[model samples]
Target: MKIILILVLFNLQSGSEVITAEFDDARACDLAALRTFQGVTAEPDMRPLDPAEGASAIEGTVIAHDSDGAEIGMYSCNPSRSDRREG
Candidate 1:
């Protein structure tokens, strides 16, 4: 199954932004998230979203910190199946 990483950035003042990337599997998606977190000094907090019928997803919140170690913004990454074509 293919996995797509959906990233949503939530900013209180401005708004929210979404970014997506496709991967071959969930492991690759999760690794990409981890690598992204490493770049911005973020704290990773992961939780599983409620599954819908036959679908399952894992969502994680990344808290970004400024250079002085202050909270800047937060974003979530959810990995799920990307192939939606019916068999």
Candidate 2:
């Protein structure tokens, strides 16, 4: 039982590898594909980008996973519509 518990802990600690691909001018449809790929059902978490803090003109979304692991979600960003200027 101790060995089994150790193996389980090791598996949870060693996260799976993730491959990323960037798409230029990506559409809303692209997000659907990502949802399918990750098997995520809950609505993604969205955060606004503030240019005053030296952040780019982009908004970020957190797509969560249904499984228990070190990584809870995938973070993606899209262009922000805020008119705030950036340095």
Candidate 3:
């Protein structure tokens, strides 16, 4: 069995932010990431998880670019823990 792990990175003023999540498949993960990105960008008070926290979050490939073509954020999905069976 395979599991989808999504990792999202956000470039912030203070520092880079990272978000990690798990889904059943790539499509689901990407869709969720897109919605989350829109919501986070729309809300000022919403802050992304710190790098350390993101690392802990058991984790697509969508990248957000600026007008100048600078990558501001990214979403990556990959397989994780295929060998570990769920109890």
Candidate 1 lDDT, 1-87, residue by residue in tens: 666766655456777666678787767877786566555555544433444699744455455555565544444444454456658
Q: What is the TM-score of each candidate against the true structure?
A: 0.49, 0.33, 0.53
lDDT of 3 by residue, 1-87 (tens): 445645455656778776777777767876776676656454223223345543643232445654454555666667776657778
CA lDDT of every candidate: 0.58, 0.37, 0.57
- Model 1 residue 55 CA deviation in Å: 15
The TM-score, computed over Cα atoms with residue i paired to residue i, of candidate 3 is 0.53
TM-score of 2: 0.33
Per-residue C-alpha lDDT of model 2 across residues 1-87, encoded as one tens digit per residue: 000000000124566434343344445434643554455434433222234665563244343444442334444434333433679
RMSD of 1: 6.3
Q: What global local distance difference test value does model 1 have? A: 0.58
- Candidate 1: list runs displaced more than 4 Å: 49-87
Worst lDDT run of 10 residues, candidate 3, spans 42-51
Candidate 3: where is the Cα deviation over 4 Å?
Answer: 40-60, 66-70, 84-87
Model 2's alpha-carbon lDDT is 0.37
RMSD list, candidates in order = 6.3, 14.3, 8.6
Ranking by TM-score: 3, 1, 2
